[model samples]
Target: MIRVLLFADLQEKAGIREIEISAEKLTINGIREHIMELYPQLTAIKTAMPAVNEEYAEGEQVVKAGDIVAFIPPVSGG
Candidate 1:
C-alpha cells in the first residue's frame, strides 16, 4: 500500500491527515485523481503539489508500494 499524507486545509477538508492506498503503483497525477474520487470535498487538491519520500515530485512520477506521498496545498502569505 502507498501511504498518502495530507496537509493544511486539505487535511481539514478530508477530516484525516493520512491515508493508505492499496494500489501497488500509481503516478502522482493518478494519486491526485484517486484522492479526489475518495474525497470530493478536497477541491483544492487539483493544484496541490505532490511529494514522494519528502521530495517534490512531478505529476508523472511513479509511486510504488510502501512509498510515502504527501499532497501540499497552495499557500499564500505576505
Candidate 2:
C-alpha cells in the first residue's frame, strides 16, 4: 500500500488527504488517472509535483509497495 498525500483544493475535492493505492497497479500516471476519475473537477494534474521518499520524482519513477508518495501542488504565496 502506497500512501499519497494531497493538498490544497485537491484534498477537498478528493475528500481525503491521504490514500492507499495498490502499488501493483499504481504508477504516477495511474494515480493521476484515478484522481481524474474520482474528481472530474481536476482538469489538469501536472501542476503538482510528485515526490517519493522525500525527493522529487518523475512520472515513471518506480515506487515500492509501501513507499510514501506526496502530491505537492504548486504554491504561489510568498
TM-score of each: 0.97, 0.80
Error of 2 at 43 (Å): 3.3
Residue range with the least summed lDDT across 10 consecutive positions in model 1: 41-50
Model 2: per-residue Cα lDDT at residue 7: 78
lDDT of 2 by residue, 2-63 (tens): 88888786777777888887666467877777777767876546678888878998898777
lDDT of 1 by residue, 1-78 (tens): 999999999999999999999999999999999999999999998899989999999999999999999999999999
lDDT of prediction 1: 0.96
Candidate 2 vs. truth: CA RMSD?
Answer: 1.8
The top-ranked prediction according to TM-score is 1
